[model samples]
Target chain A: MASKIRVKNLYKIFGPHPQQALKMLRSGLSKENLFKKTGHTVGVHNVSFAVQQGEIFVIMGLSGSGKSTLVRCINRLIEPTAGEIYVDEKKITRLPSQELRQLRQKKLAMVFQRFALFPHRTILQNVAYGLEIQGVKKGISENRAQAVLKTVGLKEWSAAYPDQLSGGMQQRVGLARALAVDPDILLMDEPFGALDPLIRKEMQEELMELQEKVHKTIIFITHDLDEALKLGDRIAIMKDGLIDQTGTPEEILIHPATEYVANFVTDVDRSKILRAKNIMIRPTAHVSINDGPRVALRKMKKEALSSIFVLGENRTLCGIVTVERAVEAVKNKETGLQQIVQTDIPTTTPETLIQDLIPVAAAAKVPIAVVNEKKKLLGIIVRVTVLAGLIGGGENNNNVGSSAESGNNVKESARSMDHISDPLPTSITGMG
Target chain B: MYLRSNYRDFFRACSGLIEGAVNNIEALLSFIPITVFILVLVILAWRLSGRGMAVFTLVSLFLLVSMNIWDETIRTLALVLTATFMALLSGVPLGILASRSDLTENILRPILDFMQTMPIFVYLLPAVMFFSIGVVPAVLATVVFSMPPAIRLTNLGIRQVPAEMIEAAASFGSTPLQMLFKIQLPLALPSIMAGINQCIMLSLSMVVIAAMIGAGGLGGIVYRAITRLQIGSGFEGGLGVVIIAIILDRITQSVGKESPEKKAA
Candidate 1:
């Protein structure tokens, strides 16, 4: 797949002689050491990355770690000292002023952290600002702004000035402004970073759902790791203007690329970031609805398992049948596994967070079923798997990067049953 | 001296134009009935400010007329307002330029300091030498004296606008002119108004000193009273000047605070 954005060897220095500073950075001087010695601050040192189309890529770091500087470089809002940035296969770093403006107007939009809605402009005018700058007709721009405002759930606020709205509403107006232009890539610099925790959480969920519908590639910068994990398809952690690591959240949690990343992920609440699909395992033996109760018992016995899940047509999960139920049905001359099957077990989607599954898994008679939208049995989350996911380590190992890639591009996985099938139901212990 | 007397015909031509402006202003203002003039002031004060300020303005102007310096007060107003208008014409653009470039600001700073800090009496000597015993020199001196605040405050206000907001505008690809008009000017309006208010106050202060140069106004009345030692006329003229200052200060201050957007949030 063609990458949506590619940044290569990006270097930014805050003082004169950027070229000399670039040389010093390339020679491996640390940001602090360089600052102390030469008095030139390094913004981003030798940073390079590619964001695939439709990816929510997060760059995370502490304050002054250069995350904001990195995002600005992508759009050339702050000219990089020396580097190249390519967007949509076009080399953008060297684009002429007019061309750069065209790209900003037509393809990319930014939402600021402080809700940079113009105080003088009404909500509708603020939302329509990008279009207005692009020379779109006033009437059309206003109509488009109204529609986008409705998308962000801020209708009836068109005529109100920014001051009349609350912070969250102002933020929505900012988002509406960006979306009104229908830009393909959204550059958000800690957009929800200033919101209260509850509003931040709500905005995170809203952004995720919005992405599901809009399918815009998002570059989100934040200092909050949980928000990064919650929103990022892949997160890049920055330290002292250098990208320490970039990987799936689970990959960072389990196989941290650097000691910095390791220490950073240590505080992350794994239960929330890890999904049921991350820890679930495939049931080795299952009885089909067409098979009799004898077939169910034989399958459970052959696999050395106490229970076997029953699958109907099209891989739809029918239910789980234990040895006792199968044996009793067989003794009574039960015709099929249908009568013996237990469908009372809770079912959850692959995306359900492990924290939400704990109660359901604890109260269940058997393992919880992880099903897809079509009710097809994708995997199973047993009590041990849920417990393992909560206490994350090698036991909770998941190929999240590959699985996510597969999930996004259907042909890559086409029912990627390999996720859970390799590790049978009973073997997933301590994935947490 | 050469321009005023040596070039006799050129001096007459210039002084004649100056006399026409001063005379027209003096006559036009005093020609209105005293009640009508006060009524206009009340209306103007009400429109810009609120009813309270309007009432305050009415009382002050009435005091000017009752104190028997009504014509003299009107004459002073014309001189002060004309000087203020000329100062704004020159000051705002110089301010905008100073705000834009460091070089311009550095150049303007020392000049404005010189204009503002020099004694007001020092200006009268130069005024009397250039356009002896007339209103032309007085208006010119007032413009020089009052123009510095407008320029300095405008520069400060523009520079004080948040750099982030300016960057936000640029990131949207706003042209240089668009950024100035659409962001900087609107945001800097209150400070600009403050600069104008200061200019008006400074011009009014110069009005009395201008009388010594033969520019007649309330300043002339006070000058007469001072020379003759007529204590009664001196007190009334002093009272008239105070009333005029109060009205202008109140009106301009209200205008400076007018922007609802800046005032609200």
Candidate 2:
């Protein structure tokens, strides 16, 4: 996949001699080795990710996780050590300071947590500041700024200074200022972190609406999993200067790849994560007309079946009756069938979070069902598959530093499952 | 012969101060109407500062007028205004420069402290030496004596703006000059206004000592009444000067208080 923004193994270490620190990092020294040799504090380490165009890619981490440092390195706000950063296929990491500044002015805009509006200027002038910096004439910049202010619902307040506005309004002005330049990307550093809860939710909705209209790629950094779930197409969960997991909201909640990710998503309700597609089991053989106990018994013995799916004359699922039910029917001896048994099965679609099935599986003491939107059976995942997805094969204790190699192992597992008769279900955990 | 000459000189000095005070009586009286207007204005100004401050301001104004030098008060105010204008003209740029560079802050700190802590009377000697006992020397001395606080405060205000705000401006495409002018200065304005208020007060306090260098107004009048043992005249003149101080203090403080609101409004 081609990336609009590509970051390759970026690292940032803050110290009195940052240039010297970068020099040492590039020599292939371990972070611990470098720390021992010099007193520099590591802000970001060996972080790499690529953002697809028009994706709302969120970077999630607690404070001091270096997610902020990683985003800053994209624009060289904090210079990265030994990285290849390509913005629009041009290697931006090595651009000279003047060129890098020009690129930033032309391509990037930032919204801050504090809003950072100028207290001295009217909102119109504050919004116009970025255009003025790009050498646009004052009248032209002001005109454009007025248009942007209206876009953010602040045109009526254009003549008022920042001090006259509420916290949410000031942040709207900040958004307007960032948008005034019409940059290709927005770097939002927890832009709503300071607002009250109600205002924060309002701002988030406003941001979603703005993103829909602008379609500019956004790299929004935050620590809140709920916020990440609500806004991100793909979320990268960072811990101790490295990515622990990157996936869709359902994936993160259902099968957290690391203890860090599980800890992060611990408070979330897993039932909410699953859809209808993930809980259905694939059937090996199809039988119609709701077969009698004598015929069902022969097939179960010949096929080595524990359970058989019953289909109606219309070729739709009627119910699943176990081989034990058929044996009990034979023992009744009155017409050789006492009852045609039916039981409710737990099921999910592919879009459903596997975590959502855990409670259903626990309540019914049966494997959860998987189904499509129409409730058509697809495949079922037992407890074994769900657990396999969490730890990647259940027995491999190797840590995530081996991610590049783990991807190959995942593909190999998928292939090996194809060869088995009465094969175990292939478990998948989506991590971007 | 010596006693007679001393007595004669004292009478002449006394008459000169009385004449000066009488000459400025209208200017001093004009301030009563302005002072009343300012007190009302200051009440509005103090609304932003709070009710407690408004009460404090009203009490201070009463104390100032009751001191009894009303005519001489206006002359002292005019001198204070003149010196303060001069100080602002010189101080704001110096403050901006000091804030922009660490080297400049280091260079100017000791100089500002020396100017601030030195006894203000020491300025009178130099004023007399150079401008020779008149209004010009008095104005110059007061301007020099009171200008440091304004510069220091302006510098402090500009330097104290949060670094995150500056970085936000930069990333949003603000040039360095725009960041300083549009972002830093506005955030720093409250502190700068505080510095200017201090400058005005310091200038007013210098006026009494300025009288010794032949800057005749209320101070010279008081000097004269004492020498001639005219207790009643001296008391009246002294009270007039106090009225002027109260009025100037109130007006400047009002102006300072109103600016932030005006900016917000």
Candidate 3:
């Protein structure tokens, strides 16, 4: 993927005589020592990262960690002490003021943490402000703002002032304001930080849903680990004005690169982040599709199991046959196990979240089969595996496929499923 | 003294220019029939403040008319308006400039303090020295005396605009000028209006002091009545000044309150 925004060696020092501080920093002086000695605070220091096109690149850190300062540096809202910034491979750090403004107007927009809707403007007017400042005609800008308002679900509130709306709705107006300009990139500075938890979650889901449609490259900043994990395609953890690690949510969770990152992930709810493929074991005993009922029963008895999955060519899961059904079929002189096989068993993709699989596991009489888009059985996740994954037991599951393949599969299933609300399919009909 | 000695022609030209402006405004006010002017003020008060202020404005102006101080009242109103207008014209932009730059703000702070704290009578000496004891000097003195609040409040208002709000505007790529007009000025409206109200009231008070320098109006009436001890006419002239002060204060204050919503609507 092409990088949408790239910041290299970015540093922002908040005080006069930053050059002296920069010299001290280059000589390996510590942030605290430098601050104590110089009375100059380091906001961001030696930070570097690239945001891929159409991806949510989250920067996670606590307050005073320079996350906000770093984001402001991108749009030149706060001038960086030193750095190079490239958007679409064009160096923006050295652009003149007029060109920088054109860049902001044409390609970038921001959603503020406080919603920052203009108090003197109606929702529609606030949303239209970016366009208006760009000198767009009033009628056209307002019409565009109206459409963006509808997208953020604030259409009816367009006539109301910012103070009249709830915090959530006001942020929706903020989101609409950024979207009104149809910028290619969005710089969101903890956009949900001020919202209550419930509203924040709702906004996160809506942002993801909106991202699916718009596909804008988004750089999201947050202090909340769960929010970063839930929304970030990739996350960079910052500490003391520097990046400690940057990786996928799974990578950050499972194999934290630094002690700080490890401590940060310790409290995360594992079930929500771990996926089905991470826990599923290789199915040991199973029946072939051509197996007779007698053979199936014998296999189940020998494996010390009550039931067994029946497989077709290419290891495709056909169905499951319980020992009782197999035995009954045998006694009735059934030649094949087709009549005995139960095709109405639950199944899930390997990319499905374990939280989504818990209820399916609780209700299923048989182990849930993990399959891919081709419906080829990858592995089987039994009730114990599901429970084990929830309690962080699947950290070293050897049966898991390559991470890249599973990552792509995750994107595919995520697009197909209604996020977080619905469980995986309870009954995927097996190939007869 | 050095400026008066060396720049006499410049001072005379400036005085002439100011005299023209004040006379034009005074003539404009006098040209409007008194009844129509009263009607316009009543309607403006009704729109800006409410019906109660409108009624008060009507009754008070009628009282001024009955007291036979109508022409003096018009003349005073013109001087006060011109002075207030000139004060705002310079003060608002200076305030904006101060808000934008720390150096400018620091430089302006003590200057504004000096302008405000010096007694109103002290400015008359310079005014008369330059413009020679007429409506021109009176108007100039009033502008000087009343201008500090306009500058101070404007600076305060723009500075008081939330930093995040300014960031929001900047993030949208607003130019400095755009940020001033679109965000800072509008958000600062209430404060600016308070400044304007102060300016008008100060101008009224100073215009009376300007009467000692021979500027004629209700102040002249009050000055004459006071010197001769005509208590009834003095009270009448004072009443006219009070009525005008109340009306302008209420109207300007309401403009700030109403404008935000009006713009939103």
Candidate 4:
């Protein structure tokens, strides 16, 4: 996919003589050191990233970390002292003032941390402001603004001023105003930061739901890690005006690229971030449906397991059969495993979060089967693995091994279901 | 000295232009029948400032009529309104300019301070020397005296518009002019209106001082009363001035408070 926005080697130094400060910065002076020496604050330092079309790219940092400055540089609200910014292959930093304004009008819009609705304008008028400034006629612009307001669930408040609305509702108006322009990209600067925790979560979920509908390429700024993890398709972690890491939420959580990133991720609740796929191990033993109850009994005994998964053609999970059932079936002289197989076992998809999987793991008599959308058996999550995944240290290594082992099993199971599946699920017991 | 000697014709031309504007406004005011004018003011006060102000405007203007000082009061009203109008016309744009640039603001601050703090008498001499004793010089001196608040308040109001709001405006691709008119000016309306109210009151006060230069109005009545030691007519003239000041103050004050959108909410 083509990148909707790309920033390269961007630097924004806030002072009269930024060029001189830029030289000192490029020559390896630290942000603090340079500031002390020349009274120049480095707002963004050589930051670079690309946002894919329709991706929610979050820039996460604490206060004064340059995330806001960096996002502003994308639209040249704060002119970058040095760097290249390209949107739709056009160089933003080099665009003349007229073209820049046109670009801002047509391609970019922003939502502020404080819901910055115009106090003097009605909600509809505030929402229509972007289109109004673009010279869209009042009648047409207002119709579209009304539609956008309806989308954000603020249609009733259209005739009211911003102060009449609650903070959450006002932010909905802010979101409506941004969407009213139909810009290809949105620059949100800590949009939910000022809201109470409950409202922030509600807004975050609403934003995700809205994103699913709009699919605009978004550049979200936040100081909250959980928000970043939840909303970001990709996240760039910024520290002291430089990017510490840029990766997907899971990658950042699982393998932080720097000590700063690692420290940052440490306090994050892993139960929310880790998924069934991250924790599931390759099943130790299973017998194809073509095999008889004797084959199931032999496999379970060999693995010293109480139960084993029974697979149909293409490794489709048919059911699980306990050793006692298999033994009883063998004693009854049953030729097929169908009679003995129990299909009522718990199952989950790979994307289910560990927090969501805990109850399913606790209540299951047999290990939970992790299947794909096609119901193809991918792996299983034993009780111990779920516990260990929640406990969360050294589990990253286990996760890596399990995923690698599962990758091999998918091919191996396709080639030969009769062959034993190695790297026992019992190995997870050692973690406890 | 340099202005008087080197720019005599330029000063005379400016004085001529101003005198024409003041006379035109005075004539326009005179064109309105006294009953119609009072009725319009009463209605305006009622709508903007409530019933009490409307009654006050009615009773007070009738008092001026009964005192037989109605024409003088109307002349004073024209002068004050003309001065305020000119001050706003010039001051608002300068304030907008100062708001846009740091250097302009820094340069304007001391100049505004000087204009506001310098005594009325100090500038009256310059006004007489330049425009030479008429409503023109009176209007000019009043504008100078009353203009500072307009500029200073406008600058302060625009500057005080929340930074986030400005960013929001910019992010939506508002041109500089659009930002000023749509966001900054609208948000700054109350402050600008306060500035205007101050300008009107200052212009009213300046009118009496202006009477010393033969700018005829209620100020002339008060000045003549004072020179001749006629306490009765002087009190009547002073009451007329007070009534006009209160009426203007109440109306403009209400204009700032009555933002349509906010009122709707």
Candidate 5:
């Protein structure tokens, strides 16, 4: 969990007299107050954040909120008026031109929102450009570029010019170009913002899968809240050149520090975004596999349940023992519940989206088993809990555990259009 | 007086190289027979432009040869080519400087404006003053007259490259020099080619004007006809200049009009 990239006290002022404006900013003047006084636009003011190694840190804001400027400052594409940006060990803002270039080539890479491809070069050549600049030999660079092209699913399009490709294909080439250098930190300035919604979603998913392998620390900039929630390991909401809040998606959804963020989450569909972990009930009527069916039937009867889960050592789900099967097994003198247990019950991971579990839930006789990677039962996601979560019944968080561990208490769900009109958070207005 | 002497000495030092190049080109072009030279130009024109332009080059050069102005026309061609080469050699570096810094652009723009706007005849005085009356002065004068367009367009071309592309190059850690060569120059090549086309045309026009300082060429023939008022010879020399102009214009204009894709990597 070491910080791969750390930015400290970053400020970007646009116009003449930035130092003067920065002084005003330090004195607690708002962006509008400074603008109204000095007529100089503030880009990013007094912003700082650290990204853990291999984390996708998304910076989201409306246009003109300086999210793009903040990203550019990390790589020095847009110089900050005052700041310290550290990519790994080097202080990028203090580095001389040669050392800065070394940092850019060796430690960091960028995927531009506009693709920013060399229109003249073929896609392969464009992808290889970073390596070529780093003085890698032509044959080796081309091979590396070709391999990265395959990773981004643009292998066959390598010979074509960027202009010849469609926008999505062009963006794939852009991603390949960034990946070709194998830099540890990727500064993505709304890389998928220009793509159509379908392609953007595919790229989001592809990036998620790709991150599992490449594990590069990425600082992604976007204006889209859904994209922020979907891709960000943690998200920072920017406004008027200042960070309003930074937290996990669930935190931003449930405890929006400002009304703007609440308004953003208030419209997000809960069923699609909420996972099994958010709704699963804790399993109580269960027994170890060593127990006999006689013991199982007694536990089931004591819990007032017809069926109970049978778990092996380490709480790995063995199967289920129905009261009828348990009774029959006991009458027949069966020693263990193994003969009576049925192992065909449906199962899902805690992270499985509720929408993904609908069909599985519809056909199941019992609640779906929410298991971890080793098949240890984490909890049970009963049908009614999923139904209640989708319907925005925040107080109806029923099932195994009554611990309301998830909600930040913002909006439970956007089941009806009325949630859209829910009062905007007053915190953002109070700040302005 | 010392400054003038030093200036003269400096011009004297460089004149041999220019003198040698001009003589070499003139000798090479004149050595080839009129028919062979025209045929070569026709083939080259065909390759660069198209068949129609090739036909025009062929017919025009043939007419100049039949007018008995072949050697003079070749001499003018040599001077124009040498001057154009010199202009590009010197202009591209200045263009790079102008593109890299505002200070250079500010310094070069006014000088470039002065070079381009002054009448062609005025430069010959300074050229003759420096090198004395010869092909060197004429070639050097033509170089001066032809250089501005190449330099200006090269500056403008480099400046016109998309900022995003430049950021991409810089973000990849391209050194200033590397970015200039790999990104700026290659992308700016089409505009550079167009600049060269203008340079060539300007040099051709100046080659005729440069003849006043004792340069040997079709320009000299045109000067002699203008002075002596020999009607038929005057018309013949004028025809020679027109033929050479058409041939060069067709070739360079076609090249300038070529797709940037063809010029780019």
Candidate 6:
């Protein structure tokens, strides 16, 4: 995966004599020593991370933990003391002010927590603000803004003042404004923090739907761990300007690396994070549907296979059979298990993350078997996928195979279907 | 017979009001030299505003002396000081009362509006009917004409003190009086001083009109100069009035400027 943004050892300090104070502080001086030399307030300490293209990266922390400041540093809205920030292979932090302005105009746009809509402008004008600043032609910018506004479901309110709109509507205008410029990456700082709970949920859903379509790299700053988990492809939990841990939500939740991370994930429900793949049995030679009915019955009798995946010629899911069906088919003079198989069985794709599959599977009280587009039976999974995923066995249990596949085919099929069936990942959904 | 009866009752009431105003004015003018000496002290107060303002004060005093009507200037000053003292005495207390009670504020509002909008010449007519033409009548007209701004501003200033500061003071266990003195008054001082500036300027302006009713001063000299076609004398007397205006303007402005800072310190 290409790195869309990479931040290395960033620091930002604020004070009356910030530059001189940082100089003293960096020269191996203590706070008291620095005070005697020059005094300043520390805002960001050494922080580092990389966001891959098309990733929903989140920085989670309380208000003063510098998550907002860190995002701003990436955009250089607030300058860092010592750091390197690269966006799309360009060193954004060191860009001259004019070039940086162009960089923001072309590639990056930011959304503020306060919405920061210009009070005097109507919603149409507010949404068009960023494009206007970039000196886009009036008609073109307005048209773009209108299109973006429609995307956020605010087309009818284009003529309304920000003060005339509700808090959520105003925030939609803010989102539309950020979207108007067709930015490659968006930096959002607590964009929904001010809304009521219902509105916030609606907005989060809207953002998720938007991300599906646009797939823009997003750096979302939020204090709500659940929000971070729900939105992030990878979450960087920050404390006092330092990244405590950076990982997928599942990785962080199941095996928190420290006491702080443990406490953060302690309240989360475990079953929700695990899926069928985590608990299902591995494929064996007798698992194949191609085996003759008498051989299959003998295999079932030996290994106690009540039901097993039945794969066709191209390693695609043909269907499944119970021991009773296989035995009945053999006694009735059927040649194969496929002739006796039940065809209407439901299955999930390998991309289906455990956290998302658990609710439907548990409610239905049936294992959602993993399958492919050609109807290939990849593997059978029960309620234990979610459990195993939650308890640190998710990554290990991801290795599921078809009834007909060799080891090579299993690995290849898993790679192709990775994260495709999962509409929402366990790392993100478990926190939600 | 009806007209005669009404006229007799009106005259009787007018005479009583005139007697009261005369007693107050006579007592106020008796302390004239001390008042002039205090005006000089007020000049010193003017100096503290800034060096530039002190320069403005000196120039205005110079213009008054050069007009060659210094004694008349002093008499005019006497009436002005007396009127201003009376206005301040009545207006400040009333403003304080109005500030405390919403009812008083509502009651005084229309009265203040009337006092401000009524013509200066119209005010003198009532004074003349009551006191029948003299310095006492002139002083009464001047005070009534100028008192509104002072009272209005004092009320506004006190009322406009921020609720936060007052709450903070109250939390510290300060009494109502302590809050009024240390917090409200200090914060409101700038606007109150602005009111005083307006009052002084209005009083100086009223002196010229007072000359028409036989209250002699630099205004009488200017009136005589005009009637006798003594253009130079009228010009000089006018210059003297302008000078007095500038000096009073400067001193009141400075007093208004310094009080809040002193309290803050």
Candidate 4 per-residue C-alpha lDDT over A280-375 given as tens digits, one digit per residue, 9 for 90 to 100? 788878899989988887777766677889999899999998878988988999999888889998999999988787667645667789999888
Query: What is the docking quality class of candidate 4?
Result: medium
Give the alpha carbon lDDT tens digit for every residue of B89-148 in model 2: 889888999999999989999989988888877766755654445776777778888899
Alpha carbon lDDT of each predicted model: 0.82, 0.71, 0.86, 0.87, 0.82, 0.72
Question: Which ranking of candidates, highest DockQ first?
Answer: 4, 3, 5, 1, 2, 6
Per-residue lDDT for B80-141 in model 4, tens only?
98899999999998988998899999999999999989988898897888877788888988
DockQ for candidate 1: 0.39
TM-score of every candidate relative to the true structure:
0.82, 0.70, 0.85, 0.88, 0.82, 0.52
lDDT of 3 by residue, A1-432 (tens): 668899999999987899899999889998889889988899999999999899999999999899999999999998999989999989999899999999998899999999988898888999999999999999999999999999988889888898889999999999999999999999999999999999999999999999999999999999999999999999999998999999998888777899999889877866678788766667667889899988877766665667888999998889899878888888899998778889899999988987788778657767788989887888877664453333332342321222421212223233323432233332211100
Name the TM-score of candidate 1. Answer: 0.82
Which ranges in model 3 have alpha carbons more than 4 Å from their true place? A281-348, A359-369, A373-377, A380-383, A389-432, B261-265
Task: List model 1 lDDT by residue over B1-265, tens digit each.
Answer: 6556678687667667756777787788878888888888899889877799899888877777777778788888889888898899999999999999999999989999999999878877866676677898898899999999999989998998888677677667676787798888888888999999899989988877888888888888888989999998888877878878878887788777777634364
Model 6, span A32-67: residue lDDT tens: 555555556667777889999989999988878888
Candidate order by lDDT, decreasing, is 4, 3, 5, 1, 6, 2
Please give the lDDT score for candidate 6.
Answer: 0.72
Give me the TM-scores of chain B across the candidates.
0.90, 0.70, 0.96, 0.96, 0.92, 0.80
**What are the clashing pairs of model 4?**
none
Which pairs of residues have clashing backbones in candidate 3?
Answer: none
**Best candidate, TM-score-wise?**
4
lDDT of 1 at B81: 81
Lowest summed lDDT window (length 10), candidate 5 chain A: A408-417
Deviation from native of the Cα of residue A328 in model 6, angstroms = 7.1
Global fold similarity of model 4 (TM-score): 0.88
DockQ of each: 0.39, 0.38, 0.53, 0.65, 0.43, 0.02
Identify the superior model by TM-score, candidate 4 or candidate 6: 4
Superior candidate under TM-score, 1 versus 3: 3
Better of 3 and 6 by lDDT: 3
Error of 1 at B166 (Å): 1.4
